[model samples]
Every structure is written in structure tokens, then in C-alpha cells.
Target: MSARFTRPGAGTPVPVRFPRIVREALDNGLRIWTIPYGAIPVATTTLVIARGTGDDPADRHGLASLTGDLLDEGAGDLDAIGVAEAFARLGTHLDIDVGPDAMTMSSAGLARQIERTLELLASVVRQPRLEAADFARIRELRVNRLRQLSRSAGTVADRAYVSAVFGDHAYGHGALGTTRALEATTVDDVRGFWAGHIGPAVATLIVVGDVVAVDVAAAARRVFDAWDATIGSSRIDRPVVAPDRRIHLVDRPGAAQSELRIGHLAPGRSTEDYHALVVLNAVLGGQFTSRINRRLREEQGITYGAHTSFDFRRAAGSFACETSVQSDATAGAVRDVIAELGRMREAAIAPEELAAASASLTRGYVRNFETAGQVARAATQLAVHGLPDDTFDRFVPAIEAIGADQVLDVARRHIRPDEATVVVVGDATVTAEALTAIDRPLQASAPEF
Candidate 1:
């Protein structure tokens, strides 16, 4: 007997429901969230501290990032090698990430080793070695990396773009501080930053795996109970984005291509129009089949690729379009990008286009909960952004509910093509004549790295 197989047809996607999360707060003020998944005998833990580069002192721009790097280099009684061995013994690895709004220390291991993992994490957070030699070596490495970035056109353009858009705001500088600032950072400065920013009051511990939530919570209590309750200043004042549109050119002599960054301020992650913005962005430039890429790469043959994104932060974020093209074609590429942004706002999208964008977004949403670790990370982001616990459950419905009118409405309200700050990194001498069409006097400056 032979069996027949048929290709699956596209069906309406059912809403996704995440595993129930057990939430609790400890005596020391650490928020503990646990999700039990028995599909596999593994567990992942993430400790998110609500302190990041945005809190760096004005004079010490990379303080938050540097502090995160040194946490596991030597902590409690373990040296850097000792710390590595500890995780190796548990058959796992420790990962650290520093961003604009927070820093996270994460690890995944066998479910049976969850207790030992939490102990190691608590030591790294509460009892960092903060040794002088480790600090010196790490700072040198970071300074060297920053110097290398100065030679890359993409990096220079990105740094110049953010600085131009934000001005003196805290978000202006890159997480990697300026060369001068890194040079000035001292061991004492790093120690002070750790003492001030790290504490239970501003931290949350998230655990997800094939383990009991009650047991996990008890284990966390035993390890982190005595941790300090001191809270740091984590509030970010809303940045004042000046409505000034201008073309700023960074002179990168002898460059063959121009790196362009065009952007303006937009709503944050918690906006009510989040779903509409996502759909709009997909049609505009967020996807490979987006209008910007099709127009520039396929139709015009001007660049290899072009894309746009919203850097959604805890506060107001920026909408940016990035691309690289021949130095001679810089002005034309910029005009095309600006025109596309305007078209998204002014024109009515076709029903087929809207359907494609919606499907693209919702189809990918299922990947968020394919593993315990991903679920935990998603939950952590919800907490970070002050979103409701059921945000994931409603995600598909929200995307499905978006109409073309709503997407266009959000585009019109959020995107401001006329107020964009354009940063161009290219051979200024070769591109001078072509850039004159931008209608703004070019402000020339050396790369500030």
C-alpha cells in the first residue's frame, strides 16, 4: 500500500499562549519570575539589571559597559579562569550583554544544576573582584577596539549620526566611549560605578526550564537573600529632539562608497500603535522584499541593499534608513530614500501589500516561544518595557487586526521625512558637487572617535 502526502496550505494562525509564569518578589527586593517547561531537562537563567550605558557618567561614557565586562573576570573567590571552569563544570556558559537601557547576565545548563548556577550568578553580581590588573587589561582592549572602528566607514557614519541626532542628550554617544573618554576612565571610576549601579532593587531574575517554579524560587532566595537592597538612579529623562534637518558630512578621504544614515525620533516600544508600526515598517524597508530594497537594488541598481528600522528603546526611539552606494550616487540614493518615506505616509497601500506585510510579521511570531530560553527572554523584555504579562498572547491578534488605514495613519504620525538628520560618510572632495542637491548647507567635521 502507498500513502499519499499533500502540501500544506496556508491556514489562519491560531493565537499563541506562553507557559504560565510564576512571579514573586524577594525580601531583598529582587523580582523573581519562573516558568516551568518539562519538554527538556535544561534550564536558562537571566539576571537583568536596569542599569546600562544611558546611566554612564557624563565624563565616563562607557562606564556601564566596562562594568558589565568585569563582573565575571574575577568575582568572589574566582579568577577569570576559575569563573570559566566553574561554568564548564556545570556544562554551560555565561553570557553578558550591555545595551542602552539595561545589562543582562545569562546562562543555560542541565536542569539538575540550577541551584549551583544561581549560586555562581549571585557571586558574580554581588561580589565582583574588581581587581586593578583586570580593569587595566579590559580597558586597554576596549580602547583598541574603538580605534579600529574609527577606520570603518559604517562605524564612523553610525557614531556621527547618533551624535548629530541627539546632540548633548545621554543617548548621543555610542556604548563604546570616545577614545579620550576611555583613556580617562580609571580603576576607581569602574569600582564606583559598580557600587552605585548594581543592587537588588534594580534587578530581576528570570528562570525558565524543566524545573519546578517553587523549587527555583527557593533556590534563588537562598543564594540572593542577603544581597544589598540599595537602588540606583535608573530614571531616564525624556530626550528633547530638536527639529532640525541638515546634511552632515564626515570627511573620509579616499573612500569609494558613501555610508548614509537617515533618521528621526519616533515612538517607543510601548506605543499603542506598535502593531501598525511593525506592519508599516515591513512594507517600507524592514523586510528583504520591502519597497526601499526593491526600488534601490532591483529597479534602480544603485546599491547592494537598503533597509530601515526603529531602534525601540525604553523611551522614545529613532527611525533610521541605512544603505551604502557609490560615492557619485550618494545624493540620488538619499533623494530616493526620502521619497519612499513620504510615499508610505501619503499613499494608500494596496490590500495585497497589506496582507503580505501582516502575514510576514505574524508568521515569524511563533519562533519566539520555540524554546524555554526564548520564552524567558521575551518575558524579561516585557518586564523591562513595563508591558502586560499577557503581551505575547495578544501579539498575533494585534498584528492581524491592523488595517491599511491604521498603518498609513501611524506612518503619517510617526515618520517625519522633512525633519531627518542625514549623516554621510564618504570622500567629501569627490561627492561635493552631487551633495549640493540636498538643499541644506553641509556641516563638515572630523570623525569624533
Candidate 2:
């Protein structure tokens, strides 16, 4: 007799509990958060300062990014090569990133090397050698990179879209400053920025993996307690998004395909309806099987793929639908994208779709804490966004509680199809006829970069 086995049905998801994160503050106002995870004999440290490109002076855009890149180039007694060798010899890695809101420096190494890594991180943060030679070299590379990006259809569309939507707002420009702005930056400007923004008063240190909260706190105190506390300027004004919708066409002559960017300003991460809006975005275009991708790519074969997302920031963010389609199909793709946006607000999502979207969110929530570094980063984000410590704990529950009605309600309230700024980057001569069919007056311009 032969025995057969049956395939298992979908099983209930196991509940995930995040590790306890202890928060403390040093005498110099440096915030420290330690999360203990002993699964591996390794540790990770991340130091986040509440300064980024948003703090770039009005005339000196991209200064913050340049400052961040120069951190590990040299420090107290180490030159650029020496800094690299120091981490290499210890089998560790230090990475730095600057965003619109904050600059983060992170490292991972063996648990025993935690103290040395923290000391090196402290030097990079507090005593970076922003030498004139280093500044000149980095600035040239950035300018060249910007020039290269200016030629890309996608890059042109992105810059043009934000410029059109935000106008004179600080967020109008990309983090990589314009060629003119990058050329204008000086070493003194960088030093001044570091003095004013990168300090203990506006910084947070996070340590995770194979460490105790008390021990991590003591280590942080040893490294950062004596640092100066110079508070930077207050946050800039929230971007003022105008309610007018316009179709801007960037002339990228002889382009093979048209890059389409359609979006409008949306709520920040702290919105009361964040969970509902997230679920709504899923059904619209947040997932591969979303309506936008399904209709544009799978059904009509207009393009390979289409998607949408909310760029959630501390203040207001934007909801964008991005895709590339044949020049002749640009207008049709735009029409279909707008139609899907409308349907999300007007139609009730099917039960299966809602269940699938909710499941996708809740199921993936556990993966965020799979590593000590990931958990530390998540906690740091919560701190950066001023969210409650329990935010992660409540994430799954909040997503699961979202009903179809709530999705529709949030969609109706947030997704404004009429107010979206439509940007197209392609050969204007070839796409003009198809694009003008949308019934809106087309505004033509060159790439702002």
C-alpha cells in the first residue's frame, strides 16, 4: 500500500513581539536607545542627528549631504584611508546616509568591538576633518553625477514633478543640490553647518544586539557625554502645496519612452488615518497585483509595470504614481492611472482584495524585527518621527482593523485626482498630440536641472 500526504492549508500567523527598547539621556542631552537581542554574537550602533538637507541654507543646497559624506573621510587622528582601514581591520562596516530630515551613521561589528566602533563613530560625528582638499574632490564628483542624472528621463521627470508641485518650497529641490548650488558650496559653509546642526542636543544614539541597556548607556556616555550641545534652527515651514493641477511637459527630445509622474501632496506619517490610507494605497498601487499595475501593465500592456507610494515624512508628504510607457501611450496611461485613483475612492474594495492587502502588511511586519540592526533602525525611525514607542507593537493591529469602508473613507478624503500634478518627460514633438488629448492646458518647459 502507498501512503499519500496532503498539502497544508494556510496557517494562522504567529504574533510577533518587539524587544524592549530602553531610552536614556546623557548629561549633554544626547539621547540613547538600547535594544538587547542575544541571538547572535554581534552588535550594531546607529547615531542619528536631527539635521539633513532640509537644513541646507537657502543659498547652499546639498550642504547637509556633503557634510554627511565627509564624516568618515577623516576624524580626530585618522585620514580618509586610515578610517577605512580601521573598520576593515576590525571586520566592521560604517555607513552614512543623509535624507530630507536626518543624517544617520551606522556600524556593525563583533560584540567585543562595540566600544571601539562607538569611539570611531563618535570621532566621525564630533570631529570630522572636513579638509579643503576633500571638499573640493567630493563636490566635483557630485556635480558630475548631477549632470549625468539630468539626462535621464526618469530623473528629469522626478525633479520636474517636485518642482512643479512644491514650487518655491524647500522640498522643491532634490537632495543632490543643483549643479549651480553644488558649485557654490565652500568648506567654511560645511564647517558652519556641522557646528550648528551636528551636536549632542539634537542627536540620538541607538545600540542593538548582544548588549544590555545599562552597559550600552554607559558606553554611550563615555563616547558622547562630553560633546557640545548647540541647538540648530527650528524646522522649516511646511511645504505649501497649491491646489491647482497642471500638466507640465519636459522636453527630452528623441526619448524612446515617456516617463510619467503624477502626484499631489499627502498627509504625513502621523496622520490619524495612516493605517487606512496605507491599506487604500495597497489596493490602488502599493502592491504588484494592485489596480494600477494590473490595469496598465497586465491588462492593457501599456508598460512593463506601474506603481504608486506615499513618501511619508515628518511634515506633509506626496503620493506619486510613476511609470514609463510608449510615447504614443502616455496620455492613455495617465488617464488609466487617474481612473484607478478615482475608483479607489468611489468603489468598495472586494473582500478578497482587502484581506490580501491587510495580510500583506501584517505578515511582513514581523520581518522588520528579524535582525538586531533592523530593530534598532525601526526604533530610531520612531524617535525621528516623534512616534510613540509602542508604534511597532500597534502596527499589525492597526492594519488588521482597517475595513473596506475605512479604506474608502480615507481614500475619499486624501486622494484628490483633480489636484494631481502630471509630469511627462519625453520627446515633446512626438508626444504632443497624444498628451494634449487630456483636455488640460499643457505647460511645456526644459528640465530644471
Candidate 3:
């Protein structure tokens, strides 16, 4: 590490320190990124492919998910049972996770097992069998999860909100996809999806804890040298923000309380307004004393709790306030929530409120990387979003730099009280009538499908 950067807080107003990940690229264009943390005997490695559900073929909404799950069933010469035993014998923890926008294959173990682990990773990504038997089992498991989600009103509200907000955008599809899509997805489709999406051009390797930077880089190169770099989705365009201001009421009979999700599209983590928006969100609905929570829950006694947040994805994400309250109180609670949003958008946040929110945000920023795993995860997120190299190092200072005016400015620009998507999951007949009687200027639309 350079000495100047080493004394991070000793100089600049917004001091920063990059994590010092060694970087290289093989002939195949697979960029290798590594961070060597030699303080412990254990190490973690993660290979993140840019392709996720966002890259799903329109007809095959569940291909990415199926591919992610089947990668661990068997690879190279190992069958499903053999792969399980190998990881178990090595005492390694391996995880495969698929999202709408990306997939991650990660593993952690003693430093001595790096070679074996790397080989396992390569095998899984390079030569998964995607056997018919394993596909049946995975599909069955996903069906069960979907079935469980069907009975949960909260789950129903959440899924409906995203689908309503994003429409046909890549993010519109849920991570656990529809049962019909899963049934239609085939092994060849999984292979083709991986070939197109999981390769070097879209790959980021993060290695942390008890490893030399050079060795980590070399390991990455050895394993990923032949992988394709420009292998993912080609249709990259700025997704249109529909910003439909409507009340989507999901009718679930016998629901005790209405589940609600409100608010609209906000800038992502990469936006220049990101820092200000963070503070603004914290003041409005991000904390216990936040205005939305205080007004809706503490003051009005409409619900036990209510809060707002921004999803902050690689692409545009949702900023939403969510809570559940008695069915009768749903209309009142949502109305109050909107009034608060309008108040926040128009008013200059009081100095005291900004101070407290800033304090909470600063405190949260400090605690964000309390664990090694968290630190690694943060790095992965930063890499994925193409954020500045010094995000973590400058996190606290960034929060401290935003004044009341800056926060209010961001709130005014992004917190759209008039355009927020208010979704309520309850008996539509009761809630719809209540909304009609309230007669607010905001228009309401019924849920379809």
C-alpha cells in the first residue's frame, strides 16, 4: 500500500483508501481481480458473472435460475453426490446464488484448499452435466417455495409491486421465476444461457482473507484463462422508467391487514446524487425516528412499523416505503404516508432532523464493514455497480459532507410524492371504496393479472 493512501484520514477532507486488489487480464479477456488478506488462515473467493435473470431470454424467464442451481449438482468428472462429498471432505462452504441481474458462485475454506476449490469452481462453470434427474429435484424445490409464497400476503404484495413497477423490464421477472417458465426450461437452454452470460468479459473475481495478492491473481488466471469475456447479454440500454402513479390493490380474501409498498424509481448507487439520496431516505423513512415511520406508526398509530428504502441496484432500482396495518386503516395509513412524502419533497428538512439522520447514517456506514464477509460483499457490490474504487474508504466522509440543503435537494428531485406507486394487498373492494371516498388528487388503478 502507498504511504500517502495508508494515512487515510490524516489528510484530505474526504480521505479514501482503495482495497488494493491486484488486477490482470488473460488472453481470453477475463479480467482477474484479487485482494490478498494475509491476516487469517482462511480465505474466501467469489466469481461473479454479469449475467443474471436480467439477461434471461424473454421466452425463457427461468434459464438463469436453473443454470445457477444446476451448476453445483455435478461438474467435470464429479456427479451430484461426488461434488457434495468433495466439498464436505475439504470443509469448504460453497454457495450458488442467482438474481435477476447476476449469478455468483462463491467458496471459502482453509488456505491450503485454494487449488482444490478453484478447480471445483472451474469445473462447475465449465462442465456442469445439468442432468435430468437433478433438474427435476431443483424444479420441485422451487415449486415448493413458490407454493409457500402464494399463501403469504406479504410475499404477494412484494412480487406484485416489482412486477407492477418494472413491467417488461429485465427486473420485472422474479428471482424464483414462474412455475411454467421453470417447467419449460431445459438442460440445453441452461448450457446455452451459461455460455452466453457466464464468462470473462462479465466476470469479477474477489478474493479476501489469508492469501497473497499475486497467488490469488495467478489462481484466477489459471482457472479463467480460457473463459469467454464478451459472453453475456448484448441488449444493454437504459430501461424506460414508466413511473405509473397508480394504486394497485391485490385482492387476497381473508387477509387480516393490508400489506403496502409505496414510492417509485430512484437513482442507483452509481448516480452522482447517491450520497444525498441516502441521507434523504434516512430522514424520510430509513430509520426508527424517520418522518414516515414516526407519522404513520408512532403518531397516528396506523401500524406497528413503517419504513422506506431504495433498492440501489446496478441498474435503476425502486425506492419504497412498506408496512402492514389493519385493513380498515389501510387507506388512512397510505394517505398519511403520501402527505409525508409531499411534505418532505417541498420542505427544507429541519436542521435537527438532518443532524440526527446524518448521525444515524454515519453510524451505519461505520458498521457496514464490521465483518470480513461483509467487507468482501461490499467490494463485490461496488465492483458490480461500477462504483468508485474508494467507496468504503470515503463512506463516512461522504455522509458527513452532505448538509441539510443537499439532502433536501436530493429529496426534492427524486422523492416523487405525485408519482409514487402505492400498492396495497387486501380486499380490493373495501380499500378501493376507501380510496374513492378520500378523493385525493392522485389517481388509482386496479391491479390486473
Candidate 4:
């Protein structure tokens, strides 16, 4: 007879020399952070604007994102096809990411081609032709995406939850926006947003891998220094949750599963309790072995998996648990999820749990700097949030130092079960009665999608 044993435990935490970053600025205000990560011959160049979807006019919810989609369609002397072919000729990949807080333009290619890639990116941002044909085509594609989002339970729950949490605030709507808002969007709107929000004062240029700071700055100035247009630099007011709003749902008729989002508005990215909150989330639902997942997925068998996150932006953020479960188990699953959220504040954290969570975060922290692209992305966060240059240098030790009491304090301060907003997308006809049976009074709203 033989006995089965679990796998080996995590190794002793090791020290890593995080990339030493050089911060330089153009005369016009675009910050340049160049990190020399060599031996790979590849470089990733990124340009970021501090404004993103949250900066979209309340009336024009998707303007920022739609403008991003049109950036590379036609630029400078190149038509849509020509622009694509130009980047292809350089063997570079161009990617645009528009999130709640910022818009990132990234190009990754051979180190020697980095200058040309930067030139192409500059053309897209500074001189996009913004052709009528491109706008109509891209706008239609976005409209199609919004249509499809209505049918997916996960997206339905996501949009509903965000809306419920923030109400009509700028952060309330998803980047894709509602059908009415997207349909009403015009090319003139795209051009206007481009002219207003894209500029050096609000931008940060980060170059990583096999590049020197002097060269990146020289190329950046040559391309962008003379272009000093910086408008729409206003900050987003911190969002407030609707006091009376508790539970929100979108009816998905005959759906077999229910997608749930439970959470509330929490502290922003710059909180002093950042490290403790990280450990708190790791214990709550940020990891597979977390409290919420262990209770709902491993013990009760209600969900396949469950996860939580603290989405930190500049001025504000959210703490949420997301999962999909059988429709019949929605109420019980929601109850159990809320209970675990409370448990963090209501109960003492076990020493093993604290050690495991700290290990989970610290052990793999170094992996974030393994590639040039990874470094670019990680650095983007620092620049976008106006974090100090030494953030990466302090990450592992910060997480390792979070103790049980500190995590509990952050959990109590940030995780708000009482104010939590519950969002579910499922067959409401079947879910309504059970949801109402729980201790929390339930409220329903028509799908916001």
C-alpha cells in the first residue's frame, strides 16, 4: 500500500534587482522612463495618457475608446492599409488599450526598429487622418460588440454591477458604453476627443529593453516636443455609491447559469494600506485557495471557480468578487460569498492563512519583470498612478511584511459587506424568490446593456 502526499511548498523568497529606471522629461511635459533590460534584442515602447474612459463626457460615454480605435486606421501620409503595412514592415506589433483610467499605446519589435516604431506611433496619435470611412467602419464594429455584450451573462452582470455601484458617475459605465451612446457617437466626436485629450503634457513615454534613455528622449522630442496641445486635463471626481442600491440584476431568460458580481467602491490605488489590502484580497478571493473560492467552489460545489479583485485607479477603485454558478444555487452562493467577506473582518486570520497569502503574492512578484513587455506594462502602472519610482523595488518586501492584524484592519476598512452591491444575470423568474429569501432585501433593475 502507498500513501499519496500533496506537492512541495513554496521556496524561500529570493531577492531581485528590479530594473533601474531613468526618468527624463521633454521640454513640453511628456515624461520618459527608460529602463535598460538587455540580452534579448527586443524592445517595448509605450505611450500613455493619464485620461481614459472616465474622462469621457457623461453624455458621450464611449468617446475615448472609439477615438483610440481610430488612431491607427489612417495616420500621417498613410492610408488605413498603408499604416498597417508600415508597422508590418518594421516587424512591430501595435496595441491600443483603453481602460477606466488611461489609454496606452504600445509597440514591441526589434531593438533596432524601435525608433521607426516610435515614429509610427507618433503619427497615429498626432496626425491620424481620422477618415470618414474608417470612423464609420470602426464605429459599426463597436456597435456590433455592444450588441453581443447584451447576450453574455458575464458581461451583463459586469455592466450592471459597475452601474449599480457608481450610478451615473463617470466610472459607472463600461468603456464600450450603452447602445444609445455608441450609436449617437460621430467621427466629429472622435476627432474632437483626439484633439483635446492627446498631448505631451498628459503623456508618459516609457521605453524598455536594449535602449538608452538619451536615445529615447531624443527620438521622443523629435516626434512630440513641438506638439504641445494638452486639453481635457481635468481630474475625475471620486465616485460615490448609491445609498439605496443594494442588489441589481439582468434577466437572462432560460440561462443555465448565473453570473454574480458582489462588491463596493473602495480606496484608490495610492492608499497607504496598499500592501495590507493586497494580502487581504489574496486571502479573500484574489487567489484560487482564497476564502470565497474555498467556501463556494471547494466546499459547497456551487461554483466552478470564484475570484475577487481590488481594481485600483487614480482617485478611486472597487473590491469585487465575481463568479458563475448554477442558476438554482445563486442565492445560496451569494449568501456564502457575503459571509466569507464578513469573515475577514469578523474572524481572526489564521497564521497559516497569512503566511500562504504572503507567499502567494511575494513568490511570483519577480516574474512581472521577466520580459521587456512585462516591464513596460508594470512601469505604465507607476506612471499612470503617479507612483514613486521605487515602487517595484519595494513590492516583495512590502507584501512579506503584511501581518494578520494589518490585513484584518485593511479588510475591515475596505471590504464593505453592508454596503455591497449584488449583481446577478440569470433567469430572474427563477432566481427572484430565492434571492428575496436571503437576509438582504433584493432589488431588481432592467438590464442596463
- Model 1 compared with the native: what TM-score? 0.96
TM-score order, best first, reads 4, 1, 2, 3
User: Distance (Å) between predicted and true CA of 421, model 3?
Assistant: 1.3
| Residue-level lDDT tens digits of model 4 in 1-449 | 33456656899776667788988887888888899996988899999988799988888888998889888888989988898899899887689999988999998999888778888888888898988888989888888898888878788888888887878778888998777887788889888888888888899888999987788878877887777685866678787656533667678789888999999898889989999998998999999999889888889998889999988888888888999999999999988988888888986699999999999998878887889999999889988898887887888888888889888888888887887889888899889889988767677776554
Ranking of predictions according to lDDT: 1, 4, 2, 3
- Two-way lDDT contest, 2 vs 4, winner: 4
**Colliding pairs, model 2:** none
For 1-449, candidate 3 gives per-residue lDDT tens digits of 77977733322233335457677777775656666654678877788877778877777776788789888899889998898888878798679888755688888788778777887887788788888888888888987888888778888778878877787888777777887777777777877777777776777777777777778777767877766534745553446867777777778767778999888877666789888888888888898989888998888887889999988777777889999988888899988989988888686888778778777766545455544465678777866777766777877788888888887788788888788887888877667788666544334433322
Q: What tens-digit string does per-residue lDDT give for candidate 2 at 85-176?
A: 99877798789999878889888888778888888888888789999999999999899999899888899899888778767776777888
Kindly list the per-residue Cα lDDT of model 1 for residues 106-222, writing each as its tens digit: 998899999999999999998999899999999999989998999999999899888887777787789988878888999899888888888988898999999898899999999
Could you give me the TM-score of model 4 versus the true structure?
0.97
Q: Give each model's whole-structure lDDT.
A: 0.88, 0.85, 0.76, 0.86
Q: How accurate is candidate 3 locally (lDDT)?
A: 0.76
> Residue 252: error of model 4 in Å?
1.3
Give the lowest summed-lDDT range of ten residues in model 2. 1-10
Estimate the overall C-alpha local distance difference test score of candidate 2. 0.85
Off by over 4 Å in 4: 1-6
Pairs of residues clashing in candidate 1: none
